[model samples]
Target chain A: MPDTAFADPDAGLSPAELAARHGLGFAGTRPTLGGYARQLWAYRHFIVAYSNARVSASFSLTRLGRLWQVLTPLTNAAVYYLIFGVVLATRHSTPNFIAYLCTGLFIFVFTQTVAQAGVASITGNMGLIRALHFPRACLPIAIALIELQNIGASMLVLTGIVLLTGEPLTWEWLLIFPALALQMIFNTGLGMFLARLGSKMTDLKQVIPFVMRTWMYGSGVFYASSLFAEHLPRWAAVIVEANPMLVYIELIRHAMLENVKLSSTLPHLWLLAVVWALVVFVGGYVYFWRGEQEYGRG
Target chain B: MGVAEVAERPAEAGQRIPTVIVDDVHVVYRVQGPGTPGSGSPVAALSRMLTGKRTPGLREVHAIKGVSFTAYRGEAIGLIGSNGSGKSTILRAIAGLLPIEKGGLYTAGQPSLLGVNAALMNDLSGERNVELGCLAMGMSKADAKKNSPSIIEFSGINERGDFASLPMRTYSSGMAARLRFAIAAAKKHDVLLIDEALATGDARFRKRSEARVRELRAEAGTVFLVSHNNQSIIDTCERAIWLESGEIRGDGPTADVIKEYQQYMNRK
Candidate 1:
């Protein structure tokens, strides 16, 4: 498919001979994505470095600088709470609904940010990708670093949420951090998938807002997953419980919420998170690599 | 008339021993129709796709077609052609940006297409793009930091002194182009592709840049340059390829190809 790969010159391309010249940080090859994964990890430094530049520069001109990172989300959560907490007064079985909503919303926002940006990642960075010879995966991973910057501020915001709610913590609270990390890995993988899809068909860009909105609501950000316990069928219930985000948010509240129960879904949640991460991480990676030669043509 | 003939030939050749082989790399693209101002419905995209009326937006244009060449270690090749004659396309394809359909392209080193691709950010200071460029070129962070000062000085932008900190966007087009050329030229690669960007800088910078290209060649690097300025190509390149309609009409001594190309132009 030389013609096929090269067919779309103005759009969709891998780096021009990037793997040939720079070696994408691997020697030899394997049948699967082991090569690509290792390459992504090796390119992690590039991701961090570039991400630092983008995040800092993106905010540099403003008066507040990095404070905008914290402020933007803090404001977003405040806006949501004022509407949902005070105006709507949506009560829940889960006490301290403010913290519950904030915790779930913050993590859910991470997934949304990555998804919104991820689809356009490779396509948008066409200029950088074309000129410089490096791993294609670095584009998506680099974007994650932007979210990682948000993590620090968001965590601070979360801790503040906890303080306001007065939720006691146990050792299980420690799991929140790792859960956040796993969620990020999952997000990165999904980002990779989106990068590939977005590069292929820009319609993904159009569909993204609707998709993220659906995901946000279904993720139980407003109330609790427990709200759906009666209406959803057994399989549907199982499916929602299996959502990696649900697991993390539920786990977060269990750890932080005042006297919340640890759902039997913990092992299932951990398994689901790992599997989702690896599946998207590895699956999206393989799909993206199969188009390696295609990236240069675009 | 049959593109299939040329496209099929490469498959018959050796499949996977890469020195720098591009076989029959043909890059064809579709012109997406301009969105018609329709009755305001979001389904306009679907409706457009459903229309089977495919008008060739323009004629089928060939950027690079059936162009074949081989370069060994230590060989410097020049590509000379009329505007839109596919000289830059050839370089981009060799750099793996375009695909060819009618021939084979082989080179030893991964090419850095050093013209349009060589450009740096104008929003940030020249220094930032330099760091980004060096890193993008795959230099380690420490190495990029180490080499950045030398690259800046090598670019002669530092001689402009403190004004260099001003965003490149503020600089004249010439200044921005010169900084880009100097920085891309700063790093040496086994294979380099030079587009016409070198003509932007002052005389002294051009001479220094020429010497750098020569030095890279002396170090056994392969260089492919695309330029309309015949004098520079003849002066710098021992060999040249003349392209017409994305086809290499002539490939041999720089003088032979340039002379033939000139004759074709004069006759027309």
Candidate 2:
């Protein structure tokens, strides 16, 4: 009755209005960037609390409480080392291999979980999603934050492994913070991409595991990037060196492994990390935002 | 009771722009199966290429036809409709969860929608979700932390051992729903949407929550409750909107609208 004209009851909010509201999303309808930013900003607290609840909920039913946090990932590292290190003899130094594999696998596992789970995050939580009016991006961001906690626990275990392996401390480990931060940014985008894809094509869920396993082999989790650094072509070596996780792992390896330099591949590493992180994050976020109105329908 | 008498009321006290405005919201739902729509799949397309026409299985559903209403401050509204009459859909779109096809929905403030079952994360503890629900209701973390204990106490589920420690998955459907209502009611939002979240609770808790909701109304806020129980709406709210097939069939004072609705329902 109060001038109901703005409520078109046809085609919803106009494209320009959407773009203005949620600037980073698909900009045709209801284009209101500042509004979307404010909404996302207001919902940040919800994201944090949701993430915290998820992380803490893991221990609520278990007898050991939060101990399962360390135990779950630590045991996983041990199991993988048994198969890949002792049995397959993954061939870094004898003692170094365990620590190396633990760091690489532990870190990589979390990233993969984020990538895989992210695809279905919005769809998976459609119940709460349909009921609440929070930013759609909050779903993936919450998972990313939760993944951070799981990875943090594993990283702590990796630190212990490195120290026990007789690797000395150095400033090189400081790089891990930035490297890990960049990986998080990169995965944030990857998660967005996967979440949008998952909603549109449900079978992508089945395909993700297959893709992840193939990615793991070439990820240098078990093999040394240094081995290939010497003989590989510059572009190929640089591209491989730039795998965000590998660079991040190298930072971890550098901190843990004494006498390891920052690597001559650092330039190539930084360049590709920056570029891929941007493409995945910005591109994925935009793609996800475009599908905002459709998510609840599923 | 007539239009002139109703119009006699000042718009501010209020009746004009209703504190909560839902203007002709139209929601269209499309059914596209897991596979590609229109073309079916690659095989379907290839077969079509080999034969004549491509198969299509996409269907568009108009969940809500054009609907409009306004509820002024201090007015507690009830939406009555059969299953999927677009009752929940309208509420969600009004709360800004679902996008509207046509129409403007302007809330005086954030409207918290607590459906019958709470629909919360089953893996979290009751208290943990309370904290989350409060935060989701737009309360600051410090405020949510401060309010969690009272919310648990109000729901009358605080005595259980697993109340704070047990996973929500371990709780009964009734218990989880109660926790959601208690938590949502903890905050002082300008507008609240309750989609029959009270049926699971005992009578005493219901009475208590109803009183709190009245208090919410007195504080310059509006509440919309969707329910099939005509008696509850007649007993609690001042206004009722009858929705049939996603359109507003009737909207007026509760007793008056309920009278018309009863006669209409009886006719069918």
Candidate 3:
């Protein structure tokens, strides 16, 4: 009877029920989509600062410092010009070949570098991930930002190349902003997707270079996408033309160069650019968001 | 089911609000070891995948087994345990860094985990890392910028040399730990879980950090200090939880629990 008198007031309640009664929520639960967006927004400063620090720290170690940002893409453009433009005779088919090759190289490198860095974002920052509590999306987003900054420097050089190549400055040149913005959105989304995949299957990092190389060859980075149409069959040509990288590169080329005719290869490329950006951004975001609780765990 | 009794309370239990509640929580780590049959070769892993079988060498380590404890607001609790014990695992689980396999952990706010090996950025200068760490902890850019100087001063990294301007990789381990603690403690946290971060500092720095821990507790935040140094625990915390082999062996006053832990260690 005395034991009955001392019995717990809520004997039927489970531990979870007790926790609920006290209004406690599970630790490390993934936030709702809106809530996740809010948290990510709050950490925007961190994303920028992290990316800035990475960019500075990376290039500062070399003798030329930040010049590498401009030099890396410029050198790649030169190499492609020698291979595809001079050796292969793609330049005869393309007008303003310098501007064309540089634009394609710069835009494609923005995405390619984003993909490479995104794959390493989560795995490479295990220290920060395990130590601090923030949105894991920050890593991929920061990778995109780092490349975006690099592309900014590359774009200045690109403008100079376009000017030196006798391409007249036209009102259409402002289209580069929108095109790069859309590409950034697309790259961020793709980076998030790859970050999630790379976190679990680290071997993806090794395979990404070959994939990007094949993609670059297909996207008309140094040659005309029209060649893909001539060489491959109809469906294959359409798929190759519809490639998001090709769409973005062609958009930039159209905006900067007056004489390069690409409307034949892919019409409504701006529409396709918007669509690719939206689809990849949303899909990658949701995919990365779902894995929020799994990123830092061993 | 029977209701488990809550953790031992202070004299002001009625006024205290619980910040962290670990209710019958379990954490298991699946680690790859050479002892497992399929752990060594990719071919074995491939065959296992083809056969729809689990990898043989993926050993399941039951890090924390049915542990339950409630930490109240403003209490600095020390986690004293032997090596391979579950002290760090429980801290990580409470911090939401590690996933719990069973049961649940409830915390009032985001629990920040600061371990000795928690490197923010090894290549960035200490000053830059301080700013970046503050931003990562949700401090606005202006606030982080405003607080960076005081945080650097508190870290004492600049006392000997201009280490704050040097990359973190150049700093000694102790200096790195000090800076990390300084950055974490700058902002008031609802729950701060520190793992062996205090053991690396000098006596004077330890005293200062212990005082800072006390100040944090005074500001209504729960602090969980995991250190092998029992003296620091007694110096910093009133209550301590002794973990042994992934289970709570004793949970009570720091002096008493540490004594119990010492005896068990000596006996073993």
Clashes of 1: 18
Q: Interface root-mean-square deviation for each candidate?
A: 10.4, 7.7, 5.4
Ranking by lDDT: 3, 2, 1
Q: TM-score per candidate, in order?
A: 0.85, 0.83, 0.92
The residue-level lDDT of candidate 1 at A72 comes to 83
- Per-residue lDDT tens digits for candidate 1, residues B160-262, read 6664677676777667766777667767787788888778778888888888889987766778888888888988887777777776677666777678888
Candidate 2 is graded, for docking, as acceptable
> What is the per-residue lDDT of model 2 for residues B1-268, given as tens digits with 9 covering 90 to 100?
2211122124353323345555566888766564455466678768875896523444678988887655556668899877778888787777767767776566655677778745676777777778788877667778988998889888877665547667678877767777888888887767788898877777887788788888887777788898888887877787777788887767766777778777878898
- For model 2 chain B, where is the 10-residue window of minimal lDDT? B1-10
The model with the greatest DockQ is: 3
lDDT of 2 by residue, A257-280 (tens): 765544445666666667777888
DockQ scores of the candidates: 0.22, 0.30, 0.47
DockQ-better candidate, 2 vs 3: 3
**Angstrom error at residue B242, model 2:** 1.3
The CAPRI class of candidate 1 is incorrect
Off by over 4 Å in 2: A1-41, A92-95, A227-238, A259-264, A274-279, A289-293, B1-15, B31-59, B159-172
Q: Write the per-residue lDDT of candidate 3 for residues B135-208, one digit (tens) a residue.
A: 99999999999999999999999999788999888999999999999999899988999999988989899889
Which structure among the candidates has the greatest TM-score? 3
